[model samples]
Target: MFLTKIDTLGNVVFSRLLGSATNAEAFSLAVDSQDNVIIAGSTTDNLGDNTRISGTDSFVTKFSARGDRIFTYQLDTVAQDKPAAIAIDADDNIILTGFSDGAINAATPSNGGRDVMLLKIDGDSGQRIDEALIGSATTERGEAVAIAEDGNILLASIDNGRAVLRKVDVNDFSNILFEQDLGQINNSGAISGLRVSGSNIFLAGSTSNSGFTGTAASIAKDFAGDTDGFVLKLTDNGSSADADFVSFVGTEAFDKINDIAVGASSVFVVGSTRGALEAGGREGPTDAFITRIDMATGAIEQVQQFGLLLTNNEATGIAFTNTGPSVLDALGLPAGTVDRIETRSVDSQTTAKAGDYFDISIDGGRKRRITLNEGDTFSDIARRINRLSFRGDVSADGSNGKLVIRANGSASVDLIAGEGSSDLLGKLGLKSQRLLGTDALFNLNDDDDQNSSSTESDLGGVFAFKLDGPLGLQDRQTAAFTLTQIQEAINTSQRAFRSLSPSILDTLGDQLGGSASGVVPTRLQSQLANYSAALSRLQSGSGGGGFFI
Candidate 1:
C-alpha cells in the first residue's frame, strides 16, 4: 500500500509503500477538512503486524498534508472484504462501501453471500463508528458511494445484475432511508454511473428491452438496438414513487453510458456508441456522444458527438473546471463524539477440569473450540480466550471471578457456547442468556436478570446496544490461533496426556503394538522392537505414525 503526493506541476513530494510482503491495492481516496488524505484499500496478509487480524481485509489509512503517515486501520469481515468506494461526511467520518461474505459487526450480520457492506470510521482514532450489511441472498456489488449534504449516505450498486440505490441514515447505518432498484440489465446492459444532485440522484446506465425496465418513466420504450443508454432521475428524500424522469436514447447499434453529470436544469450523459445514435445527427461506426436531458420533462435536449475519423473513440469522463469549488474540496466533517462500552460479569463457578473442552459461537459467527487444563483458573481461561478476541475482548472479572466481555465500540457483544459435554463450561457456569443493556453508559446492576445455563453445552447470549455511530467488528474469518499458537496448543495437549497417564509403559503401549503379544517373558524385548519401528515411521512422516501413539 502506498500514498503518493505531487504538486500541480506534477513534482513528486513524498511516496510511501506499506506491507512489503503482502499483496494490496488502493481503490479509493478521500480528504478531510484538515488536509489529511484518507485512502481505502485491501491487503492479503496481516500487513506484517500481529496486532492486525488476518484475512483478505481492507484498510483505511490517513496521511498528513506534509506527506507524513498518520495511521492505518484494517477493516475486515468474515470473508474477503473489499472497499470499492469511499466518501467523507460533514463530520469527517469516513464512509466505506464494499462487499463481504458476511457481516462485519454483531448487529449487522451477513444476510447471505457477497452482501453489500457499509462502514463508518472515526477520522481521529481510526476506529469504527458504525456498520451495516445490506443485500439479498445472492451477490451484490457496491460500485459507488456518495455522501449527502445532511450526512446521509447514498450507495449505488448492481445487485444480482440489477441496479440498486439506497440511502442510509447518518445516525444509524442499519437504518435504510430508502432502497430502490432501477431495473435488471441484460447481457450487455449495466449501471455505469451515479451522482447526487441538490435533493435528487441521477443514475446513468444501459439496459436491454427484452427483459427489464429500461427507464423509470411510466412510458416504456422498446429496445432500439442491441442495447440502449438511459438516464434516470429520482428524488433522494425517501420517496417511494418512480423516478421523476427516465430517458432512454440509442440507435441500431451498441450503445453504452459510462457517466452522468447534473446541471441546474439538465442532466448530461456520456458514453460510447458503435453505430449511428439518434441523439447525435452524425452516423458513425464508433463515436462518443454527450446527450443533455431536460430535467423536468425527461426529454433529450441536445446530442453532441465528437470523434476522430477512421478511428475508434469513446469518452469515459468529463470535467468542468472553474465552475465552482471542487466537490472534493468541500468534503469534511467536524469532530464527532466518542462512544464506548465496558461491561463485567461473573461465571457461577470455577471448577473446569483438565481435558474438558467447549466450543464458542459469537453472534452467528463460526464456532471456536476451547480446551481447559486441570490447573487452569477462571483468569487463565479468560486470558486464553481473550487472545482470540473478535468484535469484543474477554477478560477475567476479578471482582466476581467471572468473564469481563467488553465491546470496544458501541455495537452489541454476543457469546454463545456450542453444543458439547465439556464439564469445564459447566463448572464455569456458562449460560444460555444474553446481555441486555443500552449502548449508553450502564453497569451490570441488580435490575439485570441473572444469566445461567442448566445444560453445560448451551452457552449463548446476545448483547444489544444502541449507540451514536457505526459499529465495527473484527471479522471471524478463520480460527484466531496462529501457527505458533496451534503448535503450543498441541504441545499442551501432549503434556496433559502425559501427566494423566498412569504409567509410561501404558502411555507407549499403543506405539509398542499393545504389549508385544502379551507374553511376559518376551514382552520387554518385543515392545522395544515395536517402539523402534514406530519411531522410524514417525521420523519419516509416514501414515498412522506420530509421537503420541
Candidate 2:
C-alpha cells in the first residue's frame, strides 16, 4: 500500500509505502483534525510485528502530517477480519467497521458466519477502547461508517442481502440507539456510503429490487433497470427516523454508486455505469459518472461521464475539497486529460408495423400471441405484453430503441416467432430465445474464463446453427427474401460477442487484433467474409439463385 500527499497545485508533498513481503491492502482512510492520516485495512503479512495471526488480520496505522509514523495497531484474530470503512469522531477517536469471522480484541463473540465488527480506538494511544459485533446466524457485512451529530456511530451494513442502518451510542458499543432495514424483504441491496448533516442522514448504495419504492416524491419513482444506484435521505427525529426521499438512478445495464459527498447545496455521487446515464451516450462499455442532485428536492442537477472509448472505467471514491469534488477513478489516465467524443442524435422512429405479431411464453407454459395494430408504438406493444397473464413485465427502451422483457417471481421468459401472417420476431431482431429472470446478458461472468472450454463449445454450437439455419446465409433463397434475416443474424453475432467474458475478449483482441488487423482466425474470417458477401448480394439486384460462400 502507498500513500501520497499532494499540495494545492497537485505537486507531491510526501509519499510513503507501507507494506511487508506479503500482501497488504488499504480499504479506507481518514484525516484527523490535527492533520494526522489514519489508514485501516487487512493484511496477510505481519508488517514487521513478527506476530502472524490466522488468515487475514485487520490493522490501523496513523501517520503525522510530516509523514512520520505514529502508531500501528493490529487486531489479533484467529479468523479473517477486514475493515471496510473508517471515520474520525469529534475527539479524533477512530471508529472502524467491517466484517470478521470471529471476535476482535475479545470484545464480542461471533454469532455464526461472518459478522459486522465495530471498534473504537483511542486517537493518541492507538489502543482499542470498545468493540462490538452485530449479525445474525447468516452473513452480514459492515460496508460504511459515519458519525452522527449526537456523537453516535451510524453504520451501514448488509444483513442477509438487505440494506440495514444502525445508530449506536459511542460510549457503549453494544447500545443500539436506532436501527432500520432500508430495503424490502427478499430484495438484495447494499449501502456503501453514509453521511450525516444536521438531522438528515444520507445513504447511497445499489439495489436489485424493482419494487423499491421511495417514501417521498422522487425524480425516478420506478426502478430503471438491472442493479440501480440509489440515494436515500432520512430525517432523524431523536427517537425515530422518517424517510425524506429515495432517488434511484440507473440505465438498462449495471449501475452502482460507490461513494457520495455532500456539498453546500447539492449531493454529489460518483460511480460506474454500463449504459447511457446522461444526454451524452455511454463513453464505452462502462464509464465513470459524477452526478449532482438537489439536496432538498431530490432532483438531478447535472451529470458528467468520463472514460476512454472501448475501455471500462470506474469511480470508486469522491470527497468535497476546497477546489471542488475530488474523484478517485480507475481510468489510469493523467490528470486533466480529456478525450473529445463525437455524438450523434437520432430521433426515435417507429419500427412496429401494422399486423405484426409475436408469441411469448413464460416458463414453457401456454404460448400467448401478441398482435400489433396500425400506428402502434413499442410502448403499445409493451402494454399488450403486460396485459396478458404472463408472470413477467415488458418495457420499451426509448433510448436504445429496443424492447426489454423481464420475468418476475422466479419466472423465465421465452420469445418465439409467431405463425403464418403473424411473424414479427424476425423483424424485431430477436431470435427464439429463452432467458431466466435473473439472467443479464451483458453482465461479464467471471467464471466464464475458468470454464472457457464449455463456453466456447456452447457459443460455437449457437453459431453453427445460426450459420446454416433458414435465416442463415446458407439458405440463400429464404434468407434473401428480406434484410430482416441478415439483421437478425447480426444481432445474434452481437449477442455472442457480448457473451464473452472481458478477460477472454481482451486475450482475443491482443492475439488477433480483431478484424481491423486482418488477423482473425481462419474460421471466423471465413464466416465474416460469407456474411459480407451475402449482404452485398442482397443489396444488389443479382441475389437470385446464387449460393453464398
All candidates: CA RMSD (Å): 23.2, 30.3
Q: All candidates' lDDT scores? A: 0.64, 0.73
Model 1: residue 36 alpha-carbon error in angstroms: 4.2
Off by over 4 Å in 1: 1-20, 32-36, 47-55, 65-67, 105-107, 186-189, 209-215, 218-223, 239-242, 249-251, 276-291, 301-314, 323-549
lDDT of 1 by residue, 98-157 (tens): 888877768677888888888888888888898888887988877778876456888887
TM-score of 2: 0.58
Q: Candidate 2 residues 1-549, lDDT tens each?
A: 788876544666656666534578999999999888999988875532335564688899887776666667888778788999999999999999999988665447888888999999999998889999999889898999999888888888888877788898989987899888776513366676898889888888888887664354454434789898988888887656778888887888999899999987889999999989888889888999999988897878898988888899999998765553344333332343232331211111222234557788876778888886654556667777777653344323423545666665446678888653235675565678875543332222334343333333345335421344323345443345334445546655654775564457667778765545545678998999999988887677555787654
Per-candidate TM-scores read: 0.51, 0.58
